[model samples]
Target: MLGQAKAFSSFSTNDIQQTKAFYEKLGLNVKVEDMMGEMLIMQLNGGGTVLIYPKPNHEPASFTVLNFPVQDVEKAVDELTAKGIKFEQYKDLNTDEKGISHQDDFAVAWFKDPAGNILSVVKDK
Candidate 1:
C-alpha cells in the first residue's frame, strides 16, 4: 500500500454561526454540527472542516489555513466579489490589476473567513 498519506484536516474559528455564514457567503456550504462547551464544528464542502470554539479560552495545535482548487480564477473572483468578498493584497507580492496573482499553472485569489482565517483559491491543475 502507498499508506494513508495525509489524514484529516481542520481549523479553528471564534464563532460558529458567523464562521458558517461567512463560508456560505463565499459559495461554500459550511455545515455546523454538535456543540460542546464553547466549541462547535463546521464543515466546508470539498475543502475539509473548521472548528469554531469560543475565543480567549481555546488553544489549538496550530492555526488553520486552506487553499482551494477552482476551475477558473477570474470567474471565481468575480463571483466572490459580487457577493461582497474582499481580498487582501501585498505590493511586495505580484498581484494583477484585479488583485489576483497568476503564476505558472496556478492563478490565485485570496480572502479570509470571519474569525481571520486566511484562505486562497487557485486554478485547478
Candidate 2:
C-alpha cells in the first residue's frame, strides 16, 4: 500500500552547520530549513532526498547510513581524498591502501561524515 509513497531517509547530527558544510564540500546540493529547529535537506545525484536533523545528544550510527554509487571506486576515492576525506580501513574486509575492498565483482570504500555517520562509495554495477 505504501509502495507509491515518496519516502526519504533521516539521520541526526550534533551540529547542523558543520554537517552542512561538510556535505557541501563533497559537492552535494544541500539546503537549510528552519522547521522544528534547524535541519538539512540533501538532494542526491540521481534522485532522492535525505533529511538531516540536529540532536543535542547524538551518537554516530555503527552501520553505514548512506551509499553513493560511482562509476569508478578508485577515482571517487582519489577525488574525495584530495578533498581531505579519509577512508576507513576494516581489517576483515581486505581493503587496499586506499581503503577500497575489491570483491569478486565490485569495489567499495567507506568514510565517515563530520558527525561520524558512516557513508560509502560503491562501484556501480
Candidate 3:
C-alpha cells in the first residue's frame, strides 16, 4: 500500500549547526527549519530530501547511514579530502591509500560527518 508513497530518510544529530555546516560545505543545500525545535532539511541534488533532527542521546550508526553515488570514487574522495574530510580505513578490505575499497566489481569509499555518522561515496556503475 505504501509503494506509491514518497519516502525520505531521516537521522539524528547532536548539533544541528555543525551538521548543517558540514553538509553545506560539501555542496549540498541544507535548510534549517524551526519546527518546535530545529530541523535540518537537506535538499539533495537531482531531487531528494533528507531530514536531520537533533537528539540528546544521539549515537552514530555503525553502518553507512547515507550513500552518495559518484561517477568516480577516486575523484570524489580527492575532492572531499581536499575539503579536510578524512576517509575511514578498514582492516580486511582492500582499500587503497585513499581509503576506497574495490571488491565484487564495485568501488566504494567511506567517510564520517561532523556528528560521527558514517557516510559513503559509491562508484556509479
Candidate 4:
C-alpha cells in the first residue's frame, strides 16, 4: 500500500529566513520556495527532505524534530560545536562535557535551531 511511498516531514518556524540561514551554515543544501506559502526545503546528505514553513505563532517542538545518524558521535559533536552550535545538557542523563549522553550501546547529543526546535545527532548503530 503506502509502504513504498516517499514521505517527508514538515515543521514551522517563526522566521523562515533565519531558519534557512541557520541550516545553510551547517552545510545542508537548502532550497527556498514560495508557492502558496514560503517553504525551505532541506536536502539531507543521506537522501531525505524536510520542509520548513513560516508561521506567525510558531512554537518550537519540545522533543527532537530531527535526528542525524553519524559514524562518530564524538567527532560530529566536535565539528558542530566548533561551528558555534551549542549542545543541550540533560543533567539526569549523565551527559559528558560534550553534552553527549551514552546509554546501552549508543550515544546521542542534542542541539536547537534558531527557532528553538530541538535536533540531535546520534551514533549510527
Collision count of model 2: 0
Q: Comparing candidate 2 with candidate 3, which one achieves the higher lDDT?
A: 2
Candidate 1 achieves a global lDDT of 0.69
Per-model CA lDDT versus the true structure:
0.69, 0.96, 0.92, 0.93
- C-alpha displacement of 36 in model 1, angstroms? 2.4
Could you say which candidate leads in lDDT?
A: 2
On TM-score, the leading prediction is 2
- Mark the regions of model 2 whose C-alpha exceeds 4 Å error after superposition: none
- Mark the regions of model 1 whose C-alpha exceeds 4 Å error after superposition: 1-6, 38-47, 57-64
Q: Clashing residue pairs in candidate 4, if any?
A: none
Candidate with the larger TM-score of 2 and 3: 2
Q: lDDT per residue, candidate 2, 69-123, as tens digits? A: 9999999999999999999999899999999999998999999999999999999
lDDT of 3 by residue, 1-125 (tens): 99988789999999999999999989999999998699999988777889999999999888898999999899999999999999999978778999999987799999999889999999887
- For candidate 1, lDDT tens digit of each residue in 33-123? 6566554454556545555565655343332277878899889888888888887675766877766887777788777777777788788
- Residue pairs with colliding backbones in model 2 are none
Cα error, residue 122 of model 4, in Å, equals 0.3
Model 3 reaches what TM-score against the true structure?
Answer: 0.95
What tens digits encode model 4's per-residue C-alpha lDDT throughout 17-96? 99999998888999899966888999987679999999899999999999999999999999999999999999998999
lDDT for model 2, please.
0.96
Q: List per-candidate RMSD values in Å.
A: 3.7, 0.7, 1.1, 1.2
